[model samples]
Target chain A: MYSKEHKDYLKKIKLHNLLVKISQIFILVFFLVIWQFLASTERINTFIFSSPFKVFETIISLYQNDDLIHHIWVTVYETLVGFGLGCLIGITIASILWANKFLFKVFDPYLTILNSLPKVALGPIIIIWGGANATSIIIMALLISVIITIISVHQGFTNTDENKIRLMKSLGANKWQIFSKLVFPSNIGTIMSAVKVNISMSLIGVIMGEFLTSKAGIGHLIMYGSQVFNLNLIITGVFILCIVASIMYYGVVLLEKKINSKWD
Target chain B: MSVLKIKDLRKTYHTKKDEILAVDNFSFELNEGEFVAIVGPSGCGKSTILQMICGLDKKSSGEIEVPLNIKIGFMPQGDSLFEWRNVLKNCLLGLELTNNVTKENKEYVLNLLKTYGLKDFIHAHPNNLSGGMRQRVSLIRTLATKPDILLLDEPFSALDYQSRLAVSDDVYKIIKKEKKSAIMVTHDISEAISMANKVIVLSNRPCTIKNIYNIELENKSTPINNRKDKKFAYYYDLIWKDIDYHV
Candidate 1:
């Protein structure tokens, strides 16, 4: 049923995509082999660099001790909580700002200042106020993510097509009706993008909070390992963190795709 | 009977640096089932008059006398159909906004889609529609509200040359068939001559009515066919010369 030229073009595209995938895996494997080879040959210090095999061994030992799952769970839980609260508060505040132009104008400079200031620098103060607990860690994430969400989502709300707004007003729609029917629904993609950025920001804030005053978590594990000079534990913690971050980011991406498709 | 009348309508826009008078002493009237096209130079406040009529923009000073029973429907420049909504939902937007979506209203909107040859694409999104089809859908959306007077603000300007002609023909037929009075704002003089019963010309910035021409065509059926009328070029030249075009 297919034409020959079209079939050939499709095959060429598939081959190119397969090559890219293979190259990605090859690079990872090459890096692992070179690092392992150098450490074994004593060209690099294995104790400091912590080769992949040693990191894997450390993970398995930690798993046997039942500490691995608990630490991972702690960090994941904090990140999830922080992310959820940040999105809710941010969107609520954005809606409020969109509703009242005066409030938006008054808060404009304050929002900019809060957004640009380093949220990590507030970790010590957050610990002092909320104490060394999970709540403080969630608050830290909320602080980091909420301001950005408000700024981006409000921008989206205000950037709705002027003609659409005029159409709505021409239809005799009230302010609340316009916001619900036109502004909010049209900005779904914008809100989803803000959610994506917010998820990563929450994770960063959670890790920083963990570093300041956490008793358990991947951040604490890495901090404790560094203090004890256990490079293997530190490397293992970093590896687990990378995996967790990737999973969360991709989860958001999948959700964004689902929502965009529904809208389309 | 006159359905709507505006007397000495005025609009002034204020910015930080200066105040600009957009419309000055603009007065017109719409008889029942009449099509009036307002044509002027670019930025000559043609659209501001339509906006004030629809109450989208507040008039600085004027008397707009519309019978309390008459509803106003407005079609903006582009289709402005919501991407998330299908053709059916987009058409129902006006009724939905007015909280008048009764079963009869839904049936009325559905019938309009079917009558206008949009039955096959009722469930299709706006992005999938052709430019001409989108404009037709936009007109159907405006007609769905059953307004007595329609305000069209450069409705065909967004389409390409070919589709703009086709869509204008489509829109003219729809308005005439529905027996609704309309005030359409356009920069295209040929479009004004062909589609409207009367063409109103205005002067540049702080615009006022320059001249009004009652277009006399030998045989005027649709916008496309009317373009071939012998007198079409005569009216076009008159309106073209009426607008003050300068650098």
Candidate 2:
């Protein structure tokens, strides 16, 4: 009797999961059909908002033209460099602040002000200061990503188990040992979550930088396409950007899973 | 020579609002290879005494003298095992951190793991293990450091009754085999009676030792086996009475 009930329970769970998956697929199809019908009917001007088919055609053409790879490489390089720089700087600052409570208190007001301001608004100044090169884009991306890393890492350091810290100290573990073994390992989950958030922010910073001032990159392609009223190019660029960001987010998620599995 | 000597130890927490004395003029001595258990009420600052001995917390005023060359191992109330490291890695963590994981030390730790019935689960994560297994792992982690003195702060309090008994027995055997002196803190009178050679009973807040009982039994036995000894009930009653006076 128990076995039958357990089997029925499992069957119900499977059926419910299947229903959710089907509904998700149905929603996606519904949106796509509506979009296709509206574009074909000219309800929205094709020049202003290209059909998915036209965008796909543009993507193929760009790929075939060989310029797409160069643009993609440039964007990828900027995002990676900016992300690395942001993580390094943010983690360093957080460590220093964690070690020195007085320093954290001193810098608290400045961090608040910096985080509150919209970093995109500084695009013109950043370009002027960094000569509209990769430096400007990197600076923008760093601005977008660094605050998150600092806050998350600082919180991770602060939230380390007090008893564990005490235990380490009692076992003759020095300050550095405690930080490396206890503080850092315990905060891996928080740091990974912060990295996931930073991926999209990094992309946004790069695009914003390019949109304001760049001769190349997907951001430049979108800007140029918009100026020329080539909505297909713009849509294609947007789609590629989304895909890249998703891949980066999922890559970090995979890494987090791999690291967590060892312990969990 | 006494392995550890505490003289007129006093600890006070000075906050903005007030100064609160936690441990007041407490003193004790433990000879080499002695297993001491400190039992007290919840807020009696027994932990403060252990913290001072381990040098985790500074005593406001007191003197703690231990042999200069002797090392100390501390097992806190919580498991304190790194959740990211498997049992083997966690066991070797101290030696790894200290850059002292020599081949011989690794062998010693591995042997302990195997002998303690953790051989099959060496690669298991702390979260995946049972509470008793995790506590055993924590003990092994501390023992792996090869300290001369072990300070256990309610190490078995987190375990269920059955697991606690089994773990207490396991820990007792390991400590005896290792021949290491240990000081444990607990609120359980029966536990103190069953496992300790000497039990230190403490008073309420601003805690001080109320009484010290030297446990005498007919034969050597594990903690569980000792619990069945005829004198076990008498010792339990006596210690319970001492604790009750303070509470």
Candidate 3:
């Protein structure tokens, strides 16, 4: 009887999976169809609000001109650099803070105030310190991502199971041993979630920096297109940004799966 | 030789409001290879005694003496297994902490994991295991430290009734096999009688030792088996009344 019920439950899950995939595709096609129809019929001005077809044509033209890869590479490189540096510096500082209670308390109020401050307001200052090159873009992204990482990963490190720490002490584990064995491993979930949030936060910073200064990248393309009244280019840049962001987010998910499989 | 001794042990918690006495003038001596169970009314600071004994918490006054270089392993109320680690790695935590992760210690832990029913679950995460299995993994982790004495604080109470019985028996067998002195605190009267060689009963808050019983079972068997020795129920009632039960 249990086996039969289990079989029926598995069949229900398979059906649910098939229906979900079908609905996803159906929604995308339905949206594109309505968008293309409205633009082609001139119900919406194709000049200001470009159609899906024009956006696709714009992307293909950019590809033919070979600027598409360059623009994408520029943004991807900036985001990757900023992400790596932000996470590294954030975690190191957090570890140092965790190792010293006095240092953490001294910095606690300042960190809270800085985290609440709008980082975009510091974009002009970043240009002054780092210049209008890739360095400044990376700095802007770091400003966006690092504070969140510090707050989150530090929270994870401090919020480990106290009982387990006590157990370690009973077994004669010292401070460093307790931190590495108990504090670090127990916060794996928190760190992964922080990684997921950091990716998007860094992406936003890069795009905002590109808007402020860059002559290339998807963000620059959209800004330039708006100035030149090129609606197709603006729409196309936005489309590529969405796709790129999705891919990067999925990459973090895949990394999460790999790490989970390795550790857990 | 006595592995552990506590004389006039007292623990006072000083909060922002005022100081509260948790455990007051409690004392006991544990011989090598002895199994002692501490039973008291709920919220009577029984676990406080184990914490003081294991040096996890500070005592207000009195002495908790142990032989120098002697290790103490403590299993807390919850399973307290490291959730990120699989059973094997979790079992190795104590050894890893002390830099005692030698080949011999690893082999001993592996043997313990296999000898118990956790052979198939050696690769499984603690979240994936049943409560009984998690507690067994926890016990193995403690035993891996090769502590001269073990302090268990309500270790099996988190489990359901059936798993609690099975786990208590499993734990009893493992403690016996390891030949380590054990001091366990549990609220269950029958559990105290079934597993412990001696039982220590405690009064309500400002806890102090009220009475100690020398448990005797004729068959000398597992915890489940000892329950059938007819002396179990008699000792159970005696300790139950010893506790400050208001109802």
Candidate 4:
């Protein structure tokens, strides 16, 4: 039996929150519908702009044709392979950089330059070196993700509690034990955050690589769509890409929550 | 031989602007099983002395001599417990980090936690615990490593007044029962007088030991009870005067 005042306050807060969420969704839908209407009325050229219904129809037809699933599998395989390779190389290089202060100092400037350079520019070079195949796409993805991971993991290692390290040393713990227990656990959050950020970048790198060279994958599908002015096909490809990226991002978030829940 | 000995210890920070001295010409020694409290003004570098003793910071000049194979446990002013770790995991962190989580060590640690009334909250995360409970967990974590000497840098200063008193009594009973030597840094004169067998007062910045007060009070009294002792006010007045003079 809650008091009327208390119940009213709760009701008001819930209503306000619901209204805010509804307004956001409404605004997004309104813009999409306006775009769809404009494109369907021929106010915008169908070559450059497709109605939302046409995009949905194309996705349905693509699924029915059965080629979409194979392309999706190809892209997914390339992304997963690239992500694994990127994480391994990044973690190894980060550990090495953390172990050697002199190495970090020597390479710091060069790393900044490399990180600043647009990774897409290297698409041609990566293709030239690794061939115009999945290898090139994976290599391109690694180039985009590795630097970020290395920086995050290295910072995590360097920023571990000095007092904790000293305490471990006093307990007869060697350098390796300290690193394994203290430094590694402390950096889990940072590493997870880096992973989430890199998932999107890895996908982008793979797609760009495929766009430039691959005969298979969603990137090639989108390229074919653009060549024939099939805006619906392009939109369908873009929608699928967004879904994949969201799933990957949310996957990392879920993992981070699971790991962090224990500590929290 | 003393369990710990420091001679002419100095620590200075070299910066682009000017040379800053953190701990200058500080020296002291601690006997085994002794509880020593160091009291100083906020900026008097008391923490720097503890940091140097714990080997967290390098000494600019001096000799710190100890037994060849001695273990040191340090509790910093900050909680320093990983927010991600549960109370039990955090308490076991020192042992885990040292790879010394033997069954005996774990039993000893758990027994201490039980005795300290934290058994029920073992699985709870650090954030879920109260500030006082978190501090207790941190203290247990340090003690679980089975250090020869424990360094506490204002361990209870972060707690509320009531919790501070309760935790201080629990901690005092613990250190005594464990038969461990400890050096605690505190700005609270009453806390230092109540918890310590010997209170070392330090002068202003680039600190040096000014006076050492050996407290003789009713044994086994909590810090709050100790405050009511006749000698408590006297010692407090003396420390307050000394600190005021330096300021």
Off by over 4 Å in 4: A1-32, A39-41, A64-66, A262-264, B11-25, B57-72, B97-99, B216-220, B244-247
- How well is each residue in A1-264 modelled by candidate 4, as lDDT tens digits? 999999999999999999999999999899888988898778988667777878888888888885888899898888888787888888889888887899999999888888889999998888889888888898998899998888878988899887566556544567777777677887887788788888887898889988998878888888888888777888889988888788877887898889876655
Write one digit per residue (lDDT tens) for candidate 3, span B1-247.
8988889998888899999999988888999999999999999899888887877888889998999977888998789888778899989987887688999999999999999999999899888999888999999999898888999999987788999999999999989988988999999988889999999999999899899999987776899999998888888888877887888
DockQ for model 2 equals: 0.61
**Please, what are the lDDT tens digits per residue for candidate 2 over residues A162-208?**
88888787667888888888888788788878777887788899999
TM-score of chain B of each: 0.98, 0.95, 0.96, 0.93
lDDT of 2 at B167: 88
Q: Please tell me which model should have the higher TM-score, number 1 or number 4.
A: 1
Q: CA shift at B151, candidate 1, in angstroms?
A: 0.5
Model 2's TM-score against the true structure:
0.89
Query: When only chain A is evaluated, what TM-score does every model earn?
Result: 0.98, 0.93, 0.96, 0.91
Task: Please provide TM-scores, in order, for all candidate models, with all chains considered together.
Answer: 0.99, 0.89, 0.92, 0.87
- Strongest candidate by lDDT: 1
Which scores better on DockQ, 2 or 4? 2
Whole-structure CA lDDT of model 2: 0.87
| Candidate 3 positional error at A228, Å | 1.9
Question: What would the TM-score be for candidate 3 when compared with the true structure?
Answer: 0.92
The per-model lDDT (C-alpha) reads: 0.93, 0.87, 0.89, 0.83
Top DockQ hit: 1
Residue A245 lDDT in candidate 1: 97
**How close is chain A of candidate 2 to the true chain A, as a TM-score?**
0.93
